[model samples]
Target: MSEKRIEELRRQIQYYRDAYYQENQSLISDYDYDLLERELKSLELAHGVAEGSPTVLVGGKASEVFAPVKHLTPMMSLDNAFSEEEFLAWSQRAGGGPFLCEPKIDGLALSITYENGVLVKAATRGDGETGEDVTQNVLTIQGVPHRLSGSNHPAVIEIRGEVYFPLKAFEKLNADLVAAGKPPFANPRNSASGSLRQKDPAVTASRPLRMLVHGFGSFEGLNTQSEVYQLLESWGLPTTKQFAVAQDATSAYKFITQLSQKRHDLEHEIDGVVVKVDELSRQRELGATSRAPRWAIAYKYPPEQVNTKLLDIKVSIGRTGRATPFAVLAPVKVAGSEVEFATLHNQDQVRAKGILIGDTVVLRKAGDVIPEILGPVVALRNGSEREFVMPTHCPECSFELAPAQEGDVDLRCPNAESCPAQLRERIAYIGSRAALDIEALGYVSATALTQPLEPSQPPVQSEADLFDLTLEKLLPIRAYVLDPDTGLPKHDADGNPKIVDFFRKKDGSPAEVALKLLANLEEAKTRELWKILTSLSIRHVGPVAARALCNEFGSIEKILQASEDELSQVDGVGPTLASSIKDWYQESWHQRIIERWKASGVQLEIPDFAGPVLTDGIFSGMTIVVTGSMQSMTREDAEAKIIAQGGKASSSVSKKTSFVVAGPGAGSKLAKAEELGIEVIDEATFIARLAS
Candidate 1:
């Protein structure tokens, strides 16, 4: 119980925590770590030691740049267990009925406060005690809900979530950084942290930052994570849809295993599973131990790394035209798959690590994803290593690349229309379900149909030819086929049919199975007209744009004949998109394809928009903030009614908020509204008001 003893324990525990969480390494076993934590807790309890005590909760401190905002409830770090044995032991100590296991996302912790169901403030988990306000930056995140819906609005709610940069986005960002002669971030977590910490809110907003609400920091009425998550969803906050309600520890472990396998598909970064008691009563019974909740523990996954030979370094031009270098590696086992490539990111990355062709580089699949060249081993490098150079022209089209606008290092392909890569990508975008309703075609299928059929041979000459593609003919088109026999492409004598033989069956005949798929596309043309226009592979046109274009022009044929000036008049269609749309329609082949599609019986009918029907009397013209629980209707449905009634549904409550709809266990929002003198209406009262 001495001061020296407490200080020593705090230092040791901090070291271990850092090593385990940040370094992904453990110096001692879970038992040893638990013992240290227990000793520290006992010392604090006996001597009333608080300052710098190991038992003192850590995390959520306000940064110097932003004014400190005190949390209604202190944010706490979760207890961690790296092994199953440790987890079982912790469960035994807690004596719980069930536990909820969630992925421990490797990202920055954030707290979003909603007033009357509208997002008002977002702050980082600065110190576990206080946090720096980053409201403006938070607004930029597309995933973060700007407004809430429904009749159930908490007066005030503080929802906690993890903001992370996805692997794909991180790679793209690092690629830009490298091309700009800047150092790439260490990992997605670091990238997310750096992005969120930017002084300029605009800079943070520009990044592909996403968030997932995992828990609540303070809720007036919400008592459990499950309830809180449901409430968050009702308020249009982004919560993980994959959360499982495990009945017991065994089920919890099973859920963890299931999530581990599926985590890679998730957009955010997750390092481990977070296990917590599902029941609020049980969680209260389990209580806390000063630093972490006894009800929750984070089950950390083992770090994954791999060794791969750098076969070559290639530069890829992005949408922005920035050339990013990546390592084409000799297939090596990492995470769960054979990683054949790792992102070199940018030129700065290549320079910093000296990544070269023929180098044996250490590759790490962080969070079980995104193969990245950790660094090259100088000792392993031979004299034959080749340096990579940024490409001056588009690799696909040889078009001169243009640098980004002033103060930007990214380069973009100025040839947006003629560039094959951009063209293909554009096709994929137009053909997406939301845009064109092209059910039979996807990016891969469309690419296969569009790619050059033979060496120096033109691709399926026109979109009309796509309709002509029979399964049998497609099998020999090496670009479209996957050989059934070898699970690899069956090469032709000249190797020119690499893609052709790929789609073929083992019998050398076009696969009947493949034919059936193409036949379905033939039938889908009769389904709708929007499908045809959306499938035209127009540049910069997505489903929303396609719909807008269709609504304005009436049909694909009409849209094509329209001048650029006329096309630009559409709600969402800008000048660039208008030119692309006009150009696509002007193409001789494109016109022929449209004729073929119409002949095939595709009908493009304008969707009928019925006038708004009001359901309730009181809700008309009144702005409502929905935050907490609602048993009557799903949040989406509730919002629809509000909008239908000419009323607005918001996410957070503010001074302008007319009323807060408080449902069962309405949390912090309720308390905040009381303080602000905002009228709080319960679900019953809300329904009554609607009826009135």
Candidate 2:
């Protein structure tokens, strides 16, 4: 068993190493790969070490894309220590004491040779012994000086450094790429590596690349590691200002801790801190391994980016019938969570990313954000990988799919009224806090009511059927407890589709959820008219627009009677939105939804608006924009209040905006408000105004 596992680990590590070094891609996170390597080493120690085991090797060989150059002094990789224990162990082995610590920049390592104070050749760190020539590409980087500044420079000094893409510039570059309908670079490290190896120097120059000297390939006239950095800086080469000399292991660990806290604040991304023995004599005395020097070790932090296989690409029909393509990924842990799916956005996004089913893709999950597929590891693709072709018909109803407007990238299902998927999504949305606020009638219950198990009729067919679901209809119903995000049925440990007697107790009586849902649905019928309008799934009509429409027309009858021009005259309703509302009202099925809901005791009118009161309106003709989270009320409630007081609740801040309600965590909108010199008030002030 040990021998078999060792073989498997060897192959896996080799594959990942090749992906990282030769292909300019990372198939696994640094921390994960380290664990794998440690496991492989453990197993090999128990069993005999196999020939060509990765534990004895340095890195993958140079790729064929560039000319390979042998280094005068081989560039070795640093051993990694993931925890304090491991770092202490390494420190003890290396004869302990003062160490030089610097942030381990996540970038491509390079070795540049300067002959007689003039720049000559530059290469990538390939296989420790030989590296790929990237002289012209390296020269394109802005800050790299062509010639050394001081006359006291060595005859031939091999300066080792890292070429990195700035985090800020990386975001802009990715946004620009997406805007141009091109595949975005995966992460800063791979992006920097790929950029530095471009065939065209102009292409390399176009990218925002910077280099910071870290070490030297050939030691010449440098006594201490600190002196080496000072010498490099004197020669006009960029070196890290974040480096420090620590007295001992504990102090070094403190340095690592401090740097990790401010890692994101730095211009470049740092995986960890590199700890090296300070004195050159001690470093030489400690000797080196074939793969790494014994004097240096990198302490890696937990990774946010990982690579996972794209098992499939599936389209989910949303409440508004927008068909969004999402990737079904092989489960992988990233940023403290297990990620099984990542959104591809639309068909155009899938194409732009150049991803294929069965290909390994880079997955990134930052703090509290949705996991994103940066792009695919094209180097890992085999001929077996398949291109994802979006279906021309809706998977739920077999309705022909088309773009809502010409030249729009997203495709939509027009069977909004009857499609099971759309009905389920819309029903779930109606229960959302943004709509009718029916807490018990969530996605699971929505699915159970709309798409029950085989041989059982669905209790609710559409939003119209929601108010009419009886105990008899619900008690007998059984449905699959689907994945809320994908709406696909979940399976059990035995691999069969999991089914639940959704609205029933085991004894065939109505369940607690069923009772709660019924009560919630009954209560939802008496909600405010704007909430009812928002629950209809009308395109472009959110709470704000619904409130405006309700305030202007007072009733559903008046809204249906109103002309497009008349509807457009409402504060929040523009011409396009007005046309959409009119078009929605003209549909026969939509008319049935309104009539059936009205028949079921649902309120569809604003209360007590017998005469024009615009002159007496508290905020008449005012366009107020609310930004960020308020402690007293939600943005929706705030907007609703604005509409009730006869003010236009606008989403965008502009010169025409009357005032801006700013709260905690307000971002660009508040900035824009300040930039436009618009009147801005805090949540307290806005609440006072509303009360008055």
Candidate 3:
């Protein structure tokens, strides 16, 4: 290949790779991407290609949109080992014996920094040393803790780990995307990477991403690499349990081999196995090169591919009333499992691929990712082949599918309320963890409750039925069907083991589960008003906006009665959403559901939260200024304490200011308070007032 060709390939590969890994949106297939990268690598070796090729980069540069943060210690890359021989060579170079081997997760790398035993900063491993600050987004991650769990935590430490999207969550995310007429992500790693870099932290929080601590950057009171792992676990950080301490190359190689075999079985994706020297002192002595650490190595497995037939293509309607197309394939074994269905993404994707029915297709499955049709074998296509097309009308509701808005890709069915399929899915989203957080009410159970079975039971007609789910209605709700012979419930490609509630109980038995669920449903009815509002499936009303509405109106009645102008005044609730919220109440279906909910005794109003805030006590309506850092709490906390007792917290001290709470290092605000002849009190007096 020419130097120009290599340069073009390099930039193209990098852009697509970023879209794939960082944005969880892919522009090309894995094989196409691999071919481009391999071609660039080959040409670079021969032609001495241009400098700064993304092929040589560790990770994609942090997006410039976010504020940059530089690491105290440079986050370095590990040298690669494609074969056992290459890995064995590295083990020999490390001086042999006592190595730690853990799964090298195929996900985004992040650095989490803790100061004084509290998590203070979290950043992506951008271009190795420098990264974008993602502390807010990282805080929303379930596995990542805001505070260290144990008392034995390091005073100041920087822990490094991989953030990954689980397969099951990835499937749900892709389904939602498809429902919205958006393209599905290529794989879990790409999904995790893209989700973590979201500008809105709430968006990142909704993705099913988890972190596994593997190493540290700047640590105090830790002697060995093993201690780092132990400490991470003690601090309630998760680490891979499937690891081995190898004393020699043979043992290490054996563990890698074992992991390679078990890679497909993992819940999260792993590209390779990371082997590092056991001792921290030894790591320092071995030292690392500018490109990679000499003390550790990564043994990467080759990509797995399988050939299969694209039997048929079909479309499915989602809760959002968006149409998504998927392919039915002749069952073929991939990654040691039988696969049948794969997504074609959207109509644009189908046109781009030029795929036809009755064509031989190449399929590939990476660690824990769903098997995907790479492309069709044009040579193998016979005259019997037929071109596939997306339907003009909704398959479920029979309504004409139209683009959500002008030029939008998502083709949605306007029959959102009446559509049986959409209603079932919407109910599931209402009970989903991100919305109402109804315990044990997953998509399977939710759909089961909505979909009526034969002559025995009637389908749950509305949200009202959910609130009134008596024991009689619930006992027949199936979680999933069990395999008659294996006694194991069959799982989908994404490892969604829970099938939609068939008309029978699963291995756990739906009867006993119903008893627990009855109480759970009762508890769900009284959830926060914000949750109820968000779960109503109103357009433009997400978690953050819903919470803002709750803070503004404080009750369901107040929110519904709010004029469009008044609703727009709430922070984050724009004019568009305000209009949507008001219009939602106008819909006959919504009004019916509201009336039914009222009759069913569901909690429709926000709970009157009575605590700490002394409404009419002393300090009522007074403006209080807090300055400097208090010993017991921060300045913000001190100000919040004042506001809790029916007072207003002011940043500036003016003549009208009633009092100022001053602490050590109280500067301009304290001096201004004195100048204004405002009363100043110590933290002791402030605490005494709060107590009283």
Candidate 4:
């Protein structure tokens, strides 16, 4: 009788789940669904049902566009509360004297699983049981660490987070979409999900997606949620800064109400407050239904909306050569900030909305996020409204504009390296305080230096070009000067302001100014490899990644010689970025520029590091192959530690390999080690050897 009932309950539950998650149609009320799940759970417990029962799993169906992967632990949703009475009742029922409240971000759910501190898998929360693999896309997020910060952590852990697009980035994305002739995203949540699930990881990388860890899926060491939060901070993971410990039901309600009112002040979207038991033991004791943990509840708030007009559309050319479209709105306050410019996204968005230059448009801004042009006010549109069209040539460089690659919505300037606008930006970036710190030169001087040269002269297009510059040539680039005593324009014979470009005085002698710039250039040559690499303006190579590359290779020449596969072996330098780096070095123009820059005395080599050089250690002069995931640290960390101990950490196992440290998931490398008769050791023994 119980078996029959269980089977019947399963069928009904599956039907409801399919309707809610797959079809977006609710066949029953939330209360009725909860009752059904409760009945199923009771029957399962009484009859000793299998562990695979839906009573313990998640709801959403996995997307089929990518490879399907199973979750190590199910990512369950939270139960909802529509009012204070429902929430207080939940607290009383769960024995909740104290609880933790966090803002429930309205974004896509993601799971990042790390083994030995190295990020191994990133998947979306598909069905509670399965998800799609998006490891490459997750790597692109700067907030998601490639390797955990520090050591002495669990052997493995899975962090669950909400991947979101900040309001500002969302608005910018929409504007670019409008300018690219694409449809703009409706909201931050939708934009984040769509961007993260993109088939091309590079496309996803280009989007601004950030993650905030609020919980974990499967963790080996943590005992409580508070401990988890602290560990997350240590691991360099972002979390809600406004969480509070509510002592009782009333305090919890008060906190929620206060947060709800301040929601618009946040830079990202949040729909509700997630109240959960602080103690992991208490949470486990409370247990959970298949849909949500009994210890947690979401108190939802009403959505905030506003309306405004998009006055005009404009495009801006960025240094990377991507042509971005933005909206100029008639100033009106929205979401607590002054309203001026909102993003249309791209050209397709303009076409999608059928937006015209003079059309009254509906604009929305959630929180402190950048406002977006939702759509045109079709009812108010007059035929006088003009349609927007992307130009075939770049507005700044007049270079023929087209998509940088196939399947791209963005139209890019083909002459990024040589375009005056791009060059000026690049030069300024190279000279910025964050990079080489060339304090003597700034965007003002950099732009003046980039003015068109004689027909026969080499173009002054990059920061590297400045190294080849001489006092004789740059002295003539002029700026208006004022007399020091009078604070007025220094007069020439004709009563015009004296021109002083570079070091040039009214007398046309540029010697003093040229000396200052030259001295700055000399100082820049020795500014560490990481800074130099950052100043180079290589695509996708930011400060962190630049430092990683320099740490691995130690010299620009070595990095240039590295093949994509070899570059990919570096932690955080994935296939796409590796390909970009390798391809950049292969370009003939880049080759010429690098060679010229070197000849001009701009230092491109990393100085020998100062540290205790290990000698006569057991690992000294040894070639070791590290395969599989280590139990105590990341592969990159292990490799680094190995090198620190005076051993060479290699990618593959060969006959000449001195040792192979094999750990969990060891496969091909282990086989190779066996085939080659190389000495192999487990992680424990490997750690011991390193310690010795």
Q: Choose the strongest candidate by TM-score.
A: 2
The candidate, 1 or 3, that scores higher on lDDT is 3
Higher-TM-score candidate among 1 and 4? 1
Give me the displacement of residue 258 in model 1, in angstroms: 12
Q: Could you give candidate 1's per-residue lDDT for residues 287-346 as a string of tens digits? A: 876667888888876545444578888766443345566677887665556776676666
**What TM-score does candidate 3 get on C-alpha atoms?**
0.47
Query: CA lDDT, every prediction?
Result: 0.66, 0.85, 0.74, 0.73
Candidate 3: tens digits of C-alpha lDDT, residues 1-692: 39679778977988875765455554554435656776787787888745577656766677787888888788887777778888888888998868989998978889999986799999988878788899999999987888888786666788899999986677677667755755455556667877888899999978878999898887656677777788888888878887778888899989998787556556787878999998888888899866578899988776555556788888877777877788778887665577777776678766555567887776776544556665555544568989797899988779999998899887888898777667777887887765777766766566567654444464577665677777666655544443322123468879887555443356645554566667777787788777788788888886556666776677666787789999998755779999988988888878777777777777777567542223454778788888765778756456545544656666678887899887654656776776778899888998998888
Worst-scoring 10-residue span by lDDT in model 3: 479-488
Model 1 earns a TM-score of: 0.47
How many steric clashes between backbone atoms does each model show? Answer: 58, 0, 1, 29
RMSD of every candidate to native, in Å, equals: 14.4, 6.6, 18.2, 18.9
Point out the worst 10-residue segment of candidate 1 by lDDT: 481-490
What overall lDDT, based on C-alpha atoms, would model 4 receive against the true structure?
0.73
Residue 564 in model 3: shift from native, Å?
A: 62
Candidate 1 lDDT (Cα, whole model)?
0.66
